[model samples]
Target chain A: MKQRLRPILWLLLREYLEHRRLWALAIGLGLAIIALDLALSLGGQAPAGGLHVMYHSTRALESVSGNRTGTHMIGSLAALGGYDLLLNTIAVLFALTLAVALFSYGLACLYDERRDRSLLFWKSLPISDAQCVAAKAITGLAVLPLVYAVTGLTTVWAAWAINIGLPMTAGPTPPMTAARLVGFSALVLGVLPVYAISLTPGLGWLMLCSAAVRRHPAIIALGMPLLCALLNVFGLPNPIWHWVAAPLVPAGVGHALQSIEAGQAPATALAWVYQPMSQPDPWGGVILGLAFLAAATYCRRRHAVLA
Target chain B: MSESDIVIRARGVSQRFAGRPALTEIDLAVPAHRVVGLIGPNGAGKTTLINRLLGLLVGPGTIRVLGLDPARERHALMQQICFIADVATLPRWLRVAEAIRLMVRLHPGFSAAVCETLLANTDIPRRAHIGQLSKGMVAQLHLVLVLAVDARLLVLDEPTLGLDLLNRRRFYDRLLEHGRSGQRTLLITTHDVAEIEPILTDVIFLDRGRKVLDSSMDALAERFVEVVVPPAVLTEARTLEPCAERCVRDGYALIFDRSRGRDLSAIERLATARNHPTLADLFVAFRTQSNA
Candidate 1:
């Protein structure tokens, strides 16, 4: 297994070295954003009095915003930006972009093998097809996340430093609440599966497309979804049409039209998107992601077209 | 060779591309510890045949490598079989050393020492990025990677295609030195047949997606003949032998598979036989024969 992992590690290292420039950009931009946000808050306005006004007046604003205790702002500014909406927005978009970057990195990882024709080099090795495919999946699922997490933590600290150094009454204090830290950590962890879920389907499709069509994979990548959309536009009664339309239609609206005959209260919309993670299975996405990875590996091994 | 001595036995192998036949009813046997050269022009199904043996393609028949079906036992087959296409490709971001290390790590039988030795005398800096290297250096790196594996069968598809004359000669020399141990088998496909003829033990000519001829180099050298005749005698020479006649400035040349002993008395009466038909001449004869 160690022997099988060497090439994967080599590829990972190669990517890291190639995109080292991105690291500089990420840290530099992160620090710049941190400094600018801190400076804006410090320069925004000032308190009318000293410590009494600082503590009591801050509480007044907190109660008005519907939080009896406004510890949310400390973690918010330290971790995410100021507003709760902004926090969630940044959290989601950050996760989304991270996933996209990972997906693109995965694509380019395989792309290098094809463009350089070094895929033959990997194929020629004694490693099994599963090992090769697994290496790719592992890099995507494990290594990329590890790098992102490390970079994320580093940037968080830089943000903390910038906020603390600036002259602000509500600057980051030393004793952070354990609940806040734990809550924010849980939220960040919660976003992981979102990244995984977003990535798996696209990767699964790419794997199948790459194996089935040896040439012009990019064409298939862009064309397959567009073709499905066209089928929907043409009134093709495909399963994908229902899957898409089911999410778009409000159940109340559709039910009200049907209920004119029966005349009852409009039916409640069963929101598929709002399925709570605390429900039946929280790890469903994780399991599905793994299943997709397995399918991809199996397809890669059995299909001779990739050769 | 003994039955156990055969490394690759391909029987009734057929391959198609988009429902068009690339190879049909192909039968081939490659013995262990011998250098077998696959000679052909472009699109002669050489790559198709190699791909089949590597289990990269499957069709109507079976191919056995190392006594195991390559498709069913790719892991076992790959452990003993190393393949290199003539085109040079390695990750551009990798240093030459890193590529070697990766190969060493992945291939169970890879020899890091051999790879190190192969690059010892060359200017292939271990730390240099593969993209920065010249084409010949990249080819050299690929060869080093393949040769380090303790494989019984080494399949090289036109492994010197883009190499300059010096690098090409060096490649042949290094490859011959590696094969001199007489412990490994090599199957090579190349348009440059003459360049490889000196080291090849056996040769197979693939023309128009079919195997036209397969024989030992010595047997071929003894059988095929090229006759040189005065230019005016060329027309009469054509009727005497089922051969390809070409007009040289000073004299005319005719290449024929004289192993069948086609009547050549009329041509003998007019002209004398040249030294021998080289592999190139045999290639030309096969192409012309297939076309005819």
Candidate 2:
């Protein structure tokens, strides 16, 4: 088992080395966005009206709250709500960037090698073609997303630190705690597996097109579904569009983020992440994705770079 | 070579592209410890046959290299086979050291120390990308990488294409010096047949997807004789049925099949001079006869 796995692990390492620049770009862009956000929020003062509203809301809550328990609950909820809004917005942006990067990367992973005639050299090695395709799939589905998640977690922490230092309001600082950081980390981590599972079909399709198409794989990958949608005008069912959009829509990710922000128990948030797996649509998507993966392997085995 | 000595065996191996046959019923056997040359013109399926042997293409017959089915057990077959398809097969973006490292990691037969020593003889830097190097340097680097492997069979298709005469000479010299150790087999295909003829132990001529000739070098020398006949006796030499004839400065240079039981002493008496035919001469004769 060790001997069989060693070469596969090396193939994966080769993939990472070949495309590490994409990871750098993703991480660098994430940091730049965080830095720019910090510069803007810290360099500028809160508008007078916004500060006035915060002060008035705090005073109103304090005066009406004769019950300590009620006031504390309201304060905690407000704090949690504020953190959720800020963190979820950052998560959404990061997720969007990652989606674009990973989509483009996956589409080009197999295609570029053939285009450049490098596939011949790679095929000359002892590793099987299935192993080669699997390495690319893992790079796109797992490795790239993990890079984004780590960077996203770091950006979230940096933003939280910046918020603590910057005076966002004239009133007392909103309740802040390390638990907010833990919750944000948990949320990103939980959402990533769901995102990976849901996107498997789409990722597999991209790789399959990359392996099968001789020219303009990206256009084919995007245009085929568009053509399918156009065919729907004649009353044909548009399952292709649905398969392409099922993971890209990110409804499950949003739901998990919202649940975590609502101060739901961690177990409940995690359950929301796994909820998509139990759905009929996602199950179908998984089957279709697996079929695509198998096709991709076949195409890769038949592919010749110089031909 | 005996059957047990055969490392590559193909029976009725045929390939086609879109109903156009590239190779038709190719039956071949490659014995170990021999330098075999697969000589052919363009479109004769030299690369196609090599691809089949490497298990890169699956076609209409059975092929076994080192007792493993190329189609079903490519990973295992590749462990003992190394191929240099062309100079451009190496990725242009890979640095020299990275290429070596990748091979060392994936190929248990790869010897990094041998690769380093070979590269040290060239000007290729460890940090230089393949695209940054000259064509000759790329070929050299490729040769270095392949030679570092302790594979049993090495297949090269146009391995020295586009190289200068000096680099090509040095490439083949180093290849012969290191790659062939009496236990390793080499199957090479190239258009420069004259240059490669001296090292070939056996030659196979392929034309239009058909094997025109397959003979060991020693048998080739004994089977065919090139005789320069005087114009006075040209008619007598014609009776021997030479495979090909051409007018030279001295006389009519004819290539005759001595294995036809013709009296060579009689032919020698009629000839001004007689000698063995070169591989190039045999190739031309075979191609001309096939065309006719």
Candidate 3:
């Protein structure tokens, strides 16, 4: 396995070289979230990345301090799950940003080489089309997420530390401990693979379109789903907006926020992150995603000739 | 030679685009350890056949390269074959060093040292993106990449199409040296028949999607003769059934295709001069005959 992975690892590095703009967008969104957090902390505002949990906790802390006080506000904040909320907020924001970036990368990855006629050069190498497609898929769905996770975690963790060290007046300032910080980091890092897996449907669909279309892959990637949704809206019976239900789940974050606001459950990163995915089993969508990838690979192998 | 000794063998290969035929019933074999040139005009399907040979396109025939089905075993076949396609096909954003590094990592047969040595003779920079280079430089870079690979077969498609004269000669010199290893077979397609004629051991002529001629250089030399017949014997040479005749500055230059043992001695005795036709002359004659 190690022997086989060495070449694939290099191929992924090649993919990384080609897709830095997507890298920047994912990491940059994480940074922007950090900036938002800092601004909230400095401007004496409330946390909004995950707003309700942290806000209510802040309000409760202020009220308690006003009525009677000890150094237990930090304990109360942790009890209210403010830290986990903060972490989950970054997760949702990172997932969303990565999704947008993946959309652009997946659609362009296979098409641009064909357009530029660089496919000839790439095809000259000993690598197969399957290897080529695998490299791109891994980069967009798996590797990019891994790299950006570093940036995402650093942004949130750094912001968390800064807010506490600088004494934020309103946001959650849970008492920091090395164990707690390590535990929080573990939750976010642990979800990386599953996070990448949940991304397959959109990324795989875009990739298939990118390989199959001779021009304007984005239109097919975006338009086909829109066409379905529009058709659903006009005349579909018994189901309203059914086409909009499980579409790569860009609405996932919205669902998470709504669920949390409704007090159904704590917004564990796993729960909300998997919210847009089909419950009891998201593997069905995953299989569909893999099928799209397989089709993309077939298109690449079949249509390597210069147009 | 046996089937294993053949580097490329295509039998009854045919391809069509939309309703128009691009290649028709083409049969050619390039044996191992020889340089073969596929010489034709721009629309003569040279690129189409090259594409088929490399598995870039699939059609209604069998093409065996290194004894492997090019389409089914492309991954394994690619390990043994390398091609220098048209200029600027390398992505513009790729740095020369990056290309070298990538080939080294991806191709087990690629030698970065050999590639770098080839580049050292040129003014191309390792740090410069391919897009930043001139057309000639890009062609040189492409050649360097292909030449550095230790493969069983090397295919070049108009590899020097836009190169300057000096660089063109330099690239061919390197290609010739690479072919001299005696282990690699070369199959090249180009419109510059005159330039590649000296290096080709075998030549195939294609016109209007059909194989007009295919022969080894030795056979071609023995079978075809060019004569600058004087006005006195022009009619006599015509009786020899010359394949193509064109008026020269002084009289008429005629090309004769003769069967071995039948002899071109008649034309030799009647014409003012006779010699083996150059590949370029043969290409033109064959194309003219096919057109007629």
Best of the two (2, 3) by lDDT: 2
lDDT of 3 by residue, B1-292 (tens): 8988998999999999987999999998888988899888988899889889988888898899998998888878989999977767998878888888888999999988888888888899889988899888888789888888899899988888877788788778877766557488888888777788889898888887899888899999978888898888888778777878878876888988877344667778777777788888788887777777
Residue pairs clashing, model 1:
none
Off by over 4 Å in 1: A1-96, A109-112, A165-179, A186-199, A206-307, B231-242, B248-250, B262-273
> By DockQ thresholds, what CAPRI class is model 1?
acceptable
Model 3: pairs clashing at backbone N, Cα or C within 3 Å: none
- In order, the first chain's TM-score in every candidate is 0.55, 0.81, 0.68
For residues B1-292, what per-residue lDDT tens digits would candidate 2 score against the true structure? 5777898999999989889999999999888899999999999999999998888889898898988999899989888988898777788878898999899999989999999988888888899888899888888898899899899999999999889999899889888888786478999999999888888998998998888888889999889889998888889888888998889888999999977877767878878888888888888998898888
User: What docking class should model 2 receive?
Assistant: medium
**Interface C-alpha RMSD per candidate, 1 decimal:** 3.3, 1.3, 1.2
C-alpha TM-scores of all predictions = 0.76, 0.88, 0.83
* By TM-score: ranked, best first: 2, 3, 1
DockQ of prediction 1: 0.40
